[model samples]
Target: MTTTQGLGELTAAERFRSRPLTRLQRIQRLLHKHPEISPLVVLVIASFAFQLASDRFLTASNMSLILQQVSIIGALAVGQTLVILTAGIDLSVGALMIFVSMVMGSLAGNVGLPGALALLVGFAIGMLAGLINGVLVAVVRLPPFITTLGTLSVFTALALLMSHGTSIQGDDLGSVLTFTSVPVAIGPFQLTVGVILMIAMYLALGYCLNWTSWGRHVYAVGSDEDASRLAGVRTRRVLLSVYVAAGLLVALSAWVLIGRNNAATTSAAVDANLDSITAVVIGGTSLFGGRGRLTGTFIGALTVGVFRNGLSLARVDVLYQTLAIGILIIAAVALDQWIRRTGAQR
Candidate 1:
């Protein structure tokens, strides 16, 4: 063949040798094209399946419960999402949350501080904890994982130490919890304030991630820390802010948790940081960083709720329920990795 014909023949052979993209491949390609839609699909599927599996799964009361359940992880996931967006993780979020809750309970319940003042102090303490993480990670040049892991131990120990490992009683709920528990009727459906807040927070963060400059900076940083810095994105400042945001959200999550339960346990939020990370990953956030959607995280929290609730309905042993969560965590992280690989290839 002539040189041009040879080249053309090589191209044709390569094309012929290549496996045609299958339905799944094509779907992945499409999903890679629009990251936001992927989570929506997951949410839809979970909602539909839950609706089918149990008549009570999607009922107004059950839905309210779902909101409360998702709100804890969902609120905390907001911060986790922000941190992950910057390609960082905060193992201290759960610990910090416990510490904050204990502080609040101690201040208002044991120390006789005004409810409002105690709440503010609790949030501030949480923010301060986040600030410490930001400084350690950004200014002190510590790796986020190590710094947060240390803080996780330190903070949780502090919580236990401060309260002498004692459980706090039924302290009054914070505004976040009270508001979330309030019922609202809209046509045929009723929702607590917490559900609305979750929806609002999700929508706001989703927009901020997609539309705002600061949010864009987070994605850019997560996408490429080096490139983001080279682009003058103020990497340290962004990281600092991300942790602070996460801390604040953790405080909010604590409020919701305490509100729904009307108490605080030294043990309950122990694995929250781990669980929050799980939700974020399950929602499709790339642990490797640079790609994820909040909606998926939203659904992820709900997916977790459904799984837990479903297990309850199925009468699984409590130990098995924990085992199932462990399994799901692994599966979610695996799926996230797979999605990341597929996205990278595309």
Candidate 2:
């Protein structure tokens, strides 16, 4: 009887130990279920629908343009996805982007730094700003919304101070602008540096989130902080890492912006925080946090990009585009809630 009981106990322990799957398996399972199709698929459908709606949609010119336009915003959205995955939100990303951009432009143009070195400084500034936000929320225990909100105002003010509330021309920065202007082509199709940035970001983050131990910690922390802590996951560390990751991404986007337009403007990323949320939400990432994926963010970014490009091709007014995005963001949130409720019922 004692031997039988020991054998049964060992079997149960083994089962428990082997239960958890890697992040890739989790993503795969999600795709297999209804309502969790890769957000990228929705983006593709949206693109096709827009093409069908207008003659300009399928042209190589328009397609390349669409990809280019979404690059900077797409980069910002990358960070947003990371922070959101931890069941948190950062409302200051837009303002921080402005600050980082200002620093880059002013440093390289006025301060006489080399283009490459100036770019490095911009990323460092973004990381520092992000560190501030992370410390505020994770260490200081301030509410994520409130903490980021305060930083938003401060960062915006700082940006204004740095630029004297003026836009910086690309006059001194023309050398750097060439990087954004040059397009790499495959046969007849050309893609901008921005598009390449977005794609590279997607690949890197997807791997980190789906193939690494850090990704596991992010999911665990977001799913249930207290439980994750009890299970030996360092919840605070994960939160800090997520915020820092987001900030670094925002800085990377600053490069794309400089490269694309060759000018730096304070308003460039003003709507980024909202758009990032919209992209993540539309991508099928849960705003409430733990149940999101970067793949969804890519799709979400594409959806927005497609909507904007399609509307432009269809000759719709720009304000109407804003309204459509508003509606979509609200709808995505509602759908997330409904899904969670349904899952609970089951």
Candidate 3:
């Protein structure tokens, strides 16, 4: 009787140990290991679905348009991604971009400053704005949401004041300002300098995030600021640098924005603050921070562009397109929550 019991216990233990993961478990594991996979899969599926709905959806011309449309938001999202990876948010992204672009436009068009000089001034102002936000968040220890919310209002006012409620046309802004609008043809695809610049930013930031010590510290800070501090990471300096870096990118995007619109208006990209955040979240970057890829962010921005363009091609109503995007945002957040919970339990 004892021998039989021992054999049965051994069999039961072995079976339990050898149990295969269920499909859901496998999916969770995959997402945990590679958060971008979910968004990439979604992008592919959505593209195919849209293509089926409209034969024109997959055409080179239409595809190029989508890329063009996404470039501004994609660039903004790169900065947003860095801030988010540090477990912070910036509501002032759009406002800051507008303010910088307005400054650039005004200097170039009204003050007769050389376009190159105006751009350099814009960059300096952008870094200054970022520095302010960083100081508030890192030194003053203000909550990011509150800090940026306050700055958003401030930056918007500054842009309006600077522009005097007017726009600077590309003609007055000169070749340097409009350079990003110049188009390039690559095989079947038509692309802009702005698009190429956005891609380059992604590649550079992706490398920094994945392969550098600074990148690891960023993840660590986002994952647990207190723990990171305990581990000897200068959490405050990291936070400060992130905001400053974000500011530089914001300035870069402002240049792109000028080219894309063929003008710099305070009104341009008004919806970008939320749109950038939406792209970041949808790209599989955890809102809670410390987990995400730049590739996912690009995919997320492309996904939004695809959805809108595809839906328009399908003759879907604008309201429904907005609704679809809302649904995507909620779904992405929910998935992130689930992944976090499951990982904790394991």
Candidate 4:
């Protein structure tokens, strides 16, 4: 009886040790290692759930609409992602975008300048705004949150002042308003140039962040500024570069906004700053900084679009949609905290 018991115990131990990981377990392990993967999984599950609720949810036209709807937010989120990757935030991004649009409208629509030249001027102005923010953070040593918060008010006021609390809308917008109307066919779907631009920008940014030395410096600074400085990273320069790049992205987003909305209004995209941050956080970038993926941000933006569209199709009230987004933001923050704790333990 003792011999039989020993053999049985040995067999149980072997079985326990040799048990192959289940698919769910494998996925959990993958998510644990790469937190960004979690958002993508959520996106898939959300899409599946929505599709089941409404047969039209998965249609090609709706898919195209989702891309179109997200194009502007995705563009803004690109800049926000860079800032967050550096452990910084830019509350002024939306304001800067709107300001640039107003400047573009004023120059092209009212001043009678060529639309192309006006676009260039808008870009330059946007970069200047970014440069100011960078100087405050990198040189003046101001906290990013404080700097951007102050600038947010300034930019918003400037946008209102520039447009005189009015919107610029007319035939005077010329090709500037119509440029983004160009469409390309993709299999069963059609998407505007703005959507294409958003995708292209993300691709370029992904390459830069994944393959460049500058990108490494960005991560280094975000991870630990003092340590990065000690390790020969030009922390100030990196911060400045990041801010400037974000500003430029904001400007590009402004141009797309003009195309999409066909007007530059002070009131447009009022919540863009918060929305961009939401996308970044939901995409799995820790607000504490130093960890995130560009692809994740893209997925996050799409995820937002999916939620709104899905919820709308289900006839959920708009107020409820907003509540859902708020819930998502809270859940994402919780997930970030959990990931950080687990990482610390590991």
Best by the TM-score measure: 3
| Global Cα lDDT for candidate 1 | 0.75
lDDT of 1 by residue, 292-328 (tens): 8887787677777777776676566777867877876
Estimate, for each residue in 1-346, the C-alpha lDDT of model 3 and write its tens digit: 1223444355665556557778997889889888898889989999999999999999999999999999999999999999999989999999999999999999999999999999999999999999999999999999999999999999999999878899999999999988999999988999999999899999988999999999999999999999999999999999999999999999999998999999999888999999999999999999898999999999999999999999999999999999999999999999999888766755
What lDDT is reached at residue 246 by model 1? 79
**What TM-scores do the predictions have?**
0.85, 0.87, 0.94, 0.91
Q: What lDDT tens digits, residue by residue, belong to model 2 across residues 1-346?
A: 1223444455665665456666855554564343346456666777778878897898988777777878877888899888888888888888888788888888888888887787778888898888899999889989898999899999999999889877777877757633665688865668876678778988999899989999989978888889999999988888888888888888888777777777777867567778888888888888776787777787788788888989878899999999888887887777677666634532
Ten residues in sequence with the least summed lDDT for candidate 1: 1-10
Superior by lDDT: candidate 1 or candidate 4: 4
Model 4's TM-score against the true structure: 0.91
Supply candidate 3's per-residue lDDT for 218.
94
| Best-first order by lDDT | 3, 4, 2, 1
Look at candidate 4 and give me any clashing residue pairs. none
lDDT of 4 by residue, 1-346 (tens): 1223444355665556556766855654566568678789889999999999898999999999999999889999999999999999999999999999999988988898998899999999989999999999999999999999999999999999888998887467778654775788989999998898899889988899989999999989999999999999999999999999999999999988888888878878888889999999999998888988998899999999999999999899999989988998899889777667645632
Better of 2 and 3 by lDDT: 3
Scored by lDDT, the top model is 3
Candidate 3 deviant stretches above 4 angstroms: 1-20
